[model samples]
Target: MFQEKNRHLPCFAHTLDLTASDNENMKPLIEKVKKTITYFKQSVNAADELRRVQPEDKTLKLKQSLPTRWNSVFYMLERFLMLNKYVASIILSDSKAPEIMTASELEEIKEFIQILKPIESVSKELSGEKYIYHIK
Candidate 1:
């Protein structure tokens, strides 16, 4: 029999979570994006304005990231990028809307999403597993 103390195992999902969460360089950008999303989410008029401006073919709404939820930031960013055009229009026309993300920030967000996609996929797969086998 093997002693539990002699072997070490790490949680892949947890590792991924840490990697995603340890983004000090992106905190400011992320915060700005979060605030923008929060504005839309909390204001019925803003949400309605977004809906009205959005294309008929696209129905997805902005997503807010929760601290407790895994990969929420990624999802939020992904959705934000998806609706970037509509969001920009709203920000430009609405006096109450938060300032729109700069072109550099938007580009950085696209790069960030590219980097996180694979990690997110792996995390999802690891988390979705129903069982794990332990060697005896």
Candidate 2:
């Protein structure tokens, strides 16, 4: 028999991804947030301009989600929420801001972040080399 450490269990990250994707409410909001990221990435000039316009904090920068990586969506939303004020400023100045989310949509994003936080923490735990909950 192989060593105990040689065997790998089911991937928690993949399970989390599937579970989140299966949620009907999250589907549309994830797409909307992805679209917002795409809008900012579509033009280097506009993205650079936004960087200049926002504060020096790195968390204020927008992040795009990858199609295959579930955690990226969480990071994207987290950063987007962090940078909302600067994002609003950019939207006010740039005609290419794509579509602005309504107040309700913003509230939805906030809710989504709350929903994802636990999974995000679990994913982080599973990714570490040390014992789970090491940082906690």
Best by the TM-score measure: 1
lDDT of 2 by residue, 25-126 (tens): 777877877787777788787678778876576535688878677677788888888877766777777786767777888888889889888988877666
Model 1: C-alpha RMSD to truth?
Answer: 3.1
Identify the runs in model 2 with alpha carbons over 4 angstroms from their true place: 1-9, 57-60, 129-136
lDDT of 2 at 20: 64
For residues 63-125, could you state the per-residue lDDT of candidate 1 as single tens digits?
998887778889999999999888888888888888899999999999998988988888888
lDDT of 2: 0.74
Which sections of candidate 1 miss by over 4 Å?
Answer: 1-10, 133-136
The 10-residue segment with the lowest total lDDT in model 2: 127-136
| TM-score of each predicted structure versus truth | 0.86, 0.76
- Total clashing pairs for each candidate: 0, 0
Give the number of the best model, judged by lDDT: 1
lDDT of all predictions? 0.86, 0.74
Model 1 scores worst on lDDT over the 10 consecutive residues at 1-10
